[model samples]
Target: MSQSPIVLTGDRPTGPLHLGHYVGSLRQRVTLQEQYRQFVMIADAQALTDNMGDLSKVRRNVIEVALDYLAVGLDPAKSTLFIQSQLTELAELSFYLLNLVTVARLERNPTVKEEIRLRGMERDIPAGFLTYPVSQTADITAFKAALVPVGADQAPMIEQCNELVRRFNNCVGKEILVEAQALIPDHGRLVGADGGAKMSKSLGNALALSADSAAIAAFVRSMYTDPNHLRVSDPGQVEGNVVFTYLDVFDPDKAAVEELKDHYRRGGLGDTVLKRRLTEHLEALITPIRERRAQFAQDPAEVMNILRQGTERAREAAAATMSEVKAALGLSYWN
Candidate 1:
C-alpha cells in the first residue's frame, strides 16, 4: 500500500502483447499501479532499433500495445502510460549518458549480445542497436525512477544503468541522478511453444494475449511437451514440459494442476487431455481481455489521446531531470 517507490517498466511496440509479457511484467504492472508511482512506456523508439526496415509496423503497434496495457487493467489514473519516442528529453539524455559507457562494456552485456546473436545482426549491427543500453539508462534515470520491473535476463541491464548513474554523478561531483534496481517477479521467463529458451514475437514462438479462439487452439496444439511421451499410458517428464509450464502460470487451481502433473508422471494422462485443459483455461482467461481490446480497437483515437496526455506529463518530468542534469555538469544555459 506504500506508494513510496517510483517504478518504470514497459514493452516494445512491435506486436500484440503475449502471455510472456503478461507473466513477465503486465500482470505485475496492474498490481504495482496501486502501490507505486508507475510509468508504463510503449517503447516504439527501441522497437524501431530492429524494425527500421518497416517503420509502419512500429507506428501501428504503438496503439495496439497501449490497448493491451489498458485491457490488462493498468489504471491510467495511477500509472503514466506514454510512448517512448514522444519524449525528446529521453533522446537528449541518451546522448549524454553514452559518454559514460564504453563499447566493450556494451558488447559484454549478455542481454544485448544474445539479442544480436539471435537476430543474426552481428555482421550488420546498427549503431542504435548496439547503444540501447545507454538509451535504457536514459529511460530509467529521466524520471528518477528508483525501481524497474524486468525479467531475469534484464536485471544485468539495470546493473549497467546503475554503473552509468554512479559514473555520471561522480564525474559531475553530485548525486543528481538516482540509481535503479530490478524488481524481478517470481514467474520470470516464459519459454516459447517450440520449447525454445524464450518467447518472442520476432521468433514467431509466442501466444499473443489478443489471439482469437482459433489462434489459441493452434498455439496450444503446437506447444511442445515431453517428446518421449508418445502414448497416453507413457510416463511423462514435467520439468521441461511446456504445457505444464503454461498451466503453472495460468491455472488458478494449484491443487488441480499438481494432481494433473502427478497423473501425467504416473503414466495415464495424454497430451491431448492436458492440452485441452490448457486450452479451456486460456480461452476463459483471454476472452474478456479480447473483448476489451475489441472495444478499444473501435476507438483508437481515445487510446492515442490517453498516450498523449501521459506523454505530456512524462515529458515534464523528463524536462525537470534534464535541467538538473545540465546544471550538474555546469551546462545549463541562460535562465
Candidate 2:
C-alpha cells in the first residue's frame, strides 16, 4: 500500500505567532493535520542562527510558540510537534547534505540573499545563518515530506531543497530523499500594520495571537490606511491599504467588506469606520485563541511532556532516515 503523504513545516520561536502567521500558514496547518501526517517543528536551532547571543530568549519563546500552536488548534494526537534541536540526527544529516551543495549555490539562493539584505547582515553573517537552507533540506528529507507550505517569496528555499535531493540521490545511487512541492496560498502575502511588505516582530508591526483586546484595539487604531486619503470624503486607494488587505483575509463577511471597499474607493468611508469593523472581525478570531493560550499556559509541564514524546517519535524517524543515508554513503561498517 502507498504511504500517506507527509508535510513538514515549522516556525522560528523568535516571537509569538502573529496574525500574519494566522493568515499565511497557521490556519492551513490546523486543517492539514486531518488530511496528512504532519510535523510541526519548533525551530529553536534555526532561531539561534540569527540570535546566537540570546539563547535565553530562544528557550523562553519555544514554549511561547508551542502554546501558540496548541492554542491555534494543532492537535498533538494528529500532528507530531517537536523541537528541532532535540533531533541531533538532523544536524548530522545537514553535515552530509552540506557537502552535496556548494558555497556558490548557497550564496546564490534568492531567499537567503534577501534575508541578509533585510537583516542588514551583509557585513557580518554567521556561517550557521548562511547555511540554513541545507539544514532545512535535512529537516524536510528526514521525514520524507512531500508537501511544504511556503509563501511566494520562499519558493527559492523549496527549489534549493529539491536540488539537494537530486544531488544526494544521484551521488548515493539511491532516491532516499524526497523532493517536496511548495503549497502556495491563494491569498497574497500579508503586509504589516505599518504598511511594510512583511509583518515582523522586529519592526513592531505585528499583532500577536496573544495580544489582548486592548492591544488589538491599539493595533487597529494605529494601523496604516491610505496615506493620501486625509479626509473621509477623499477617494482612498484600496490597492495598497493595509486595513482592506487584512479584511480580505480575516473578515468572513465578504459582501460587507466589499461594500466598504467600494465606498472607500468612491469616497466618504472614513478610516475610523473601516477600522471599527476590522476590530470586531479580528476580535472574533483572537479572543478564542487568547482563551486557549491562557489555559495551556497554566500547565507548562504538560506542554513540555507533549514535546518530549513528540521528540522521541521524531528521533526514531530521523534515525531511520540517517541509517539509510549512511548506508548509501558506505559509512555503515558497524551497522
Candidate 3:
C-alpha cells in the first residue's frame, strides 16, 4: 500500500493557544491527522528567535502547547507530536541549507520582512530571525514533508522553502530534497478581540483555549463591535466587527449566524444581546477543550512522555534524511 503523504505543521511555544489558533489552523489539524501522516512540532527553538531572554517561558510553554494539542484532538496515536529542539539533526540540516541561500534573498522574504517590521527590529535583526526561512526549510525537508498547512500569509515562506529545495537538488545534480506545497485553509485570518489585523499572545487581545467561563465572558464583553453601534436603534456595520467574525467562524448554525448578522446590521440588536449570544457559543465550544486540557495537565509526566516518544520517531526520520543530505553535499567522508 502506498503511504500517505507527510504533513508537517506546528506552533511556536511562546504561549498557550488561543481562539485565533482554533479558527485558523488547530481546527484543520484535527481533520488532517486522520488522512495524512502528520507531525506536530512544538517549535521551542524558533520561539527563541525573539524570546531568548525568557528561557523558562519557552520551556514552560512546550508542555503547555503539547497539552493544548492533546486537548484539541490531535491524537498521539495518529499524529506525532514532537519538540523541535530535541531533533538536533534539524539544526544540522538548517546550518547546511543556510549556505545555499544568500543573505540578500533571506532579507527579501516577505514573511521575514513583515516579522521584522512587526517586532520593531529593523535596526538590529537577529541573524537567526532573518534566516528563519532556512530553518523552516530544514524542518520541512528533513521530514520529507510534501504538504505544509499554514496561513495564507505564509505563502512566501513556502516559496522560499521550495527555492531552497530546487537549489539543493541542482547543486547535487539530483532531486534529493522534495519541494513542498502550502495548504492554506478556507477560513481567512482570525482578527483579534480588539479588532486588530492579527491575534497574538503578546498583544493581550487573544482568548486562550483553556480560558474559564468568567474569562470567556470578559473577553466576549470586551470584543470590538461597531463603534457607531452606540444605541440599540442605530444600524451597525459588520465589516470589521470582531464579534460577528467570531460568530461566523465558531457558530455551527450558519443560518442562525446570518440571521443574527441581518438583525445586527438593520439595528435593534443591542451589543449586549449580540455579545451574550457570542459568549454562549464560545463557552460551548471551549468548555470541553478546557476540561480536556485540565485532565491532561494533571499528568504532565505523560505529556512529556508522549513528546519524548514522538521525538524519537521524528529523530529517526530526520537522521535518515540528514545522512542523505550529507552524502549529497559530499560531506560523508568517513563513509
Candidate topping lDDT: 3
Task: Give the best candidate by TM-score.
Answer: 3
Error of 3 at 176 (Å): 1.2
TM-score versus the correct structure, for each prediction: 0.93, 0.94, 0.95
Q: In model 2, where do residues sit more than 4 Å from their true spots?
A: 119-124, 228-231
**Local distance difference test, each candidate:** 0.91, 0.91, 0.92
The lDDT ranking, best first, is 3, 2, 1
Which residue pairs show collisions in model 3? none
| Winner by lDDT between candidate 3 and candidate 2 | 3
> Over the stretch 1-335, how does candidate 1's per-residue lDDT look in tens digits?
43378899898888889988888888889899888899899999999987889999999888989999988888889999999998989999999999999999999999989989988888488999889999999999999898999877888899999999999999999999999989989886889999898799888899887899999999999998999998999999998899999999889999999999999999989999989999999999888888888888899889899999999988988899999998888887797
lDDT of 1 at 68: 95
Worst 10 residues of 2 by lDDT: 1-10
List of clashing residue pairs for candidate 2 = none
Model 1 steric clash pairs: none
Q: State how far residue 282 of model 2 sits from its true place (Å).
A: 0.5
